[model samples]
Target: MNSFCNVKSVMRSMFSGFIAATVILISTYAIAETTMEKVKRTGVMTAGNSGSYPPFSVMEGKTLLGFDVDLANELGRRMGIKVKFEVIDFKGIIASLKAKRVDTLITAMTKTPGRAKQILFSVPYYDAGLGALTAKGSGILKPEDLTGKIVGVQLGSSGERYVRSTLGKKVKQVKTYDAILLAVQDLKIGRVAAVVNPIPVLRYNSKGAQLVTTPVWKRRAVGINTRKEDADLMAWIDKHLSAMKNEGFLERLDKKWFEG
Candidate 1:
C-alpha cells in the first residue's frame, strides 16, 4: 500500500511538470509569429515611413510617391499580399517597428553599424550618401564651409550624426528638425544656414536651395529595415532585392526615378 501511494504521488508530480512546460511553450508560440507569417495571415504588410522625404517617399495631396513607395508595393506583390504604408515620424520609426506597430520600414533608412544593432537589413538597393542644401549663392563651397554656420538635419537621422561626427565643432550650431523637409525649408527662409541629408533629398528639394557639390558625406547602403527577430522575413526581403538586382528590375526603377 505504501509503495503504491509513493508511485501515485510521483506520477502526479511528473504530470504537473509536463503540463507547466507545455503551457510555457504554447505561450511562446502564440506570440512568436514571424513578420512574414503575420503578413500572410493578415493579407497585408505595413511599411512605415515619414512620407516627408521626396524622390524616395513624400506625401503629394494624400498620395504617397517615390522610389520607396514602389519598393514596398513590390515586396507585398512578391509575397502575394497587399502593402499598406503608415506615415510615422522618422524619429519614431524604429521604436514603432520594435513595438510591432510596423512590419517593415521602407523609409530611406540607411544601413549603419549603429542601426544594425537594433534591426536587420536587406541588401543594399541604392547607392546613397549625405549632401547639404543651402540658400543659393551662400558661398558654402564645401562641407567644411559650414563652419560658424547653423546646419540643420532631421532629428534622429544619420544626417544629425554625420554633422556631429564629421563636422563636430566646425559648425557653430546644429539645428534639428522633425523632418528633413523642414530643415530644407529653414534653409530657404534663412532660419538655418544649411540642411544636411541624403543626396537625393537635397537634390530634389533644391528648387530654391543650392545643393553642395564638393562633399558627399556619410556614403552608405540603404535597405529595408526589419525586426531582428524576423529572420524569415529578412531573408525573403534580401532574396527579393537580389532578384530585382539580377533581373534589371532595379535598374529600370533607378532610371525611372533617379534618371528622370
Candidate 2:
C-alpha cells in the first residue's frame, strides 16, 4: 500500500510539471514579438516616399494624400502605432530606408532585382507599366513613333530605365525630371515629344496630353520594401496585404485612385 501511494504522488507531480511546461511553451509562441513587435513597442512606424509623385503619393497644400499614403496609415493603424511619412527625392528613398532613416518605403516602388538586393519586398500590391504621354496631335502613337524625338522621364523611375535601355538610343535626348508630372509639363509645352511614366500617372496627369498605351515597360509590380532580416515585419505586412486583397479593399483603392 505504501509503495502504491508513493507512485501515485510521483505521477501527480510529473503531471503538474508537464502542464506548466506546456503553458510556458504556449505563452512563448503567443507572446514572443517578432520584428513587428519591436516597432510596436517603439510606438511608431516611419514610411518613406517621394511626395511629388502624383496619384501614389502627392503633396497638396501641406497635406500628403494618395493611395500609398492611405495604405501606410492603414498599416500603422493596424499595428497600433503612429505612422510618420518622410518625403524626399525618389532617388534617395531606398538609401534613406537602408540607412534606417525610415522603417519602410511606401512609394510606388517597383520590385526589381537591384532593389531586392538591398531590401526585402513584400508581396506585390500594385502592377505598373511604362507608358507615354504625348501632346495632342504630337503623332507619338507608340514606342517606335517617339524615335528620334526628345523623351522625358521621371528621374530614378522605371520609365527612365526603359527609355535608357529601350528608347534612349533612338531618341534625340532622354530628359530626366524630378517628377513625372514635370515631364508631363514638358510634354505639353513641346520640350519633349513625349513623357514616359507609369500608365496610372498618365491617366490622371494627362491634361493636354494623350496617354499612349503602347508601353515601353510592361506589368512591373510594386510592393513595400523593408530592411533585410525584418522577417516579422514582413510577415505582418504580407498578412495584412493579403487580407486587404481578399476583402476587396485593394480593388477599391485601384478603382478609386488608378481608374479614376
Candidate 3:
C-alpha cells in the first residue's frame, strides 16, 4: 500500500509538470505569433510606394521623402521595427505584394472593388480625387475640354480609367514616365496638352509648372495595401490608422501636404 501511494504521487507530479510545460510553450508561441514580434524578427518591414509621387512620396536627392514616407516610418516605429522603402511602378505594386517583395504598400492607392478582390485594404488615411492639370495658358479646364487633345496620365491609374470612360476612344492618350508623376517634363514643355492625376498629387507636384487644376471627380479613399491572407498585419494597420485618425495625425498630414 505504501509503494502504491508513492507511485500515484509521482505520477501526479509528472502530469502536473507536463501540463505546466505545455502551457508555457503555448504562451511562448502566442507571443512569437504577434505581428510586432514577427516584424521585429524580420528586422525591417519592406514597404512599396511610387517614389515619384510628390508630397505623398518623392525622391529628394537619394532619400525618399513625403507624407507616405513619414507615415510608413511612423508605422514602423509603432511596430518596433525598421522600414525599407522599395520604389515600384504603380501597376506592379499589387504584384509585388503577392510576390512578397514588400510587406505592405503605402502608396496613394485608391480602395476600389477590383483591387479589393486581390488584396485587403486598411482603413482610409487619405481622401483624393481625379483632377486635370493644364499649363497656365492652356485652354483646357474641364474633362469635356480634353477632347481631341493629348492628355498625359499614369498607366493603370484611376485617372486613366476615368479619362477613358468619360472621354471615350477619341481622346489622345499620353503615358507618363511612371505611375505617379503624371506631369512628365515634356508635358510642361508643350509636348502634351495637359496631365490628369489625383488632385492632391497634381497640386503637390506642381511647384513652378504654371499649372492649374480642375476638380472633376469626387474624393476617393486611400488605404494601405496588404496581401489578402495577411489578416494579422491588416488588423495591425487598421488599428494604427484608427488611432491616427482619432489623434488627428491624418488631418495634420493633409494640412501639411494638401492644405498648405
Candidate 4:
C-alpha cells in the first residue's frame, strides 16, 4: 500500500511539472511581439529605400523627395505613426532588411522568386522593366546590339540578372554599380557601351542628358518587402495600399511623378 501511494505521488509530481512547462510555452508565444505591435507600441515605422532612385526616392539638396517618400509618409499618416527612412545601397538593402535594420523596404524592389524566398512581399505597388541607355549615336538600339560590348548594371537588380543569365558569354564584360546613375555616368564617358536599368528611370535620366533609350525587355511587379515572420505587418501594409489604390490616391501620385 505504501509503494502504491509512492507511485501515485510520483505521478502527481510528473503531471504538475508537465503542466508548468506547457504554461510557460504558452506564455512565451503570448508575449512574442509582432512587427505591427512593435510599430504601434513605439509609434514609428522604419522604411528602407535606395534614396538614389529618383521619382521613387531621392535626395534633393539634403531633403528626401519623391514618389516613394510621399507614399511612405501617407502610409505613416494612416497608421498614426511617424515613418523613418533608412537610405541604403541597393546591393545591401535586402541584407539590411533581414538584419532588422529597417522594418520594411519601399525601394522599388521588384518581386523575384529568389527574393520572395528570403522576404515577404506586400501586394505589388508598381510595374517597371529593364531598358538600355547608350550614347545617342552608340547604335545600341536593342538587347541584341549589346553582344561583345561592355555593359553596366546596378548590382542586385533584375537588369543585372537578365544580362548575366541571358547575355552570358555574349557580352565582353558586365560592370556593376551601386546606383543606376553611376552606371549612366560610366556610359557617358564610354567606360561602358550601355547601361541597363528600369525603363522609366532610363527615360527620366535620359531627358536632355544625351542618352538613347531602348525598348523594354520585360516588365515586372514592384512590391514592398518585409521579414517573413512579419505576416501581420505585411497584411497591414497590403490593406492600406489596396485602399490607397481604390481611393485614387495612387493615380494622383502616378500623374505627379511618373507621367507629369
Candidate number of the best TM-score: 4
Per-residue lDDT over 37-68 for candidate 3, one digit per residue giving the tens place of the 0 to 100 score: 56667878788987877788888788998899
Per-candidate clashes, comma-separated: 0, 0, 0, 0
> Per-residue lDDT for 196-242 in model 2, tens only?
77787886887434544444446678999889978678888888887
Per-model RMSD to reference: 5.1, 10.2, 7.4, 6.1
Give each model's whole-structure lDDT. 0.83, 0.81, 0.79, 0.87
**Better lDDT candidate (1, 2):** 1
lDDT-sorted candidate list, best first = 4, 1, 2, 3
The better-scoring model by TM-score among 1 and 4 is: 4
Candidate 2 wrong stretches, greater than 4 Å: 1-37, 208-217
lDDT string for model 4 (237-260, tens) is 899998988888888988899788
Across residues 90-184, which tens digit of lDDT does each residue of candidate 1 receive?
98899999999999998989877889999998898987877777766788757788899999998988888888988899899999988777787
Model 2, residue pairs in steric clash:
none
Residue clash pairs of candidate 1: none
Show where candidate 1 strays beyond 4 Å: 1-29, 208-212
Task: For candidate 4, list the clashing residue pairs, or say none.
Answer: none
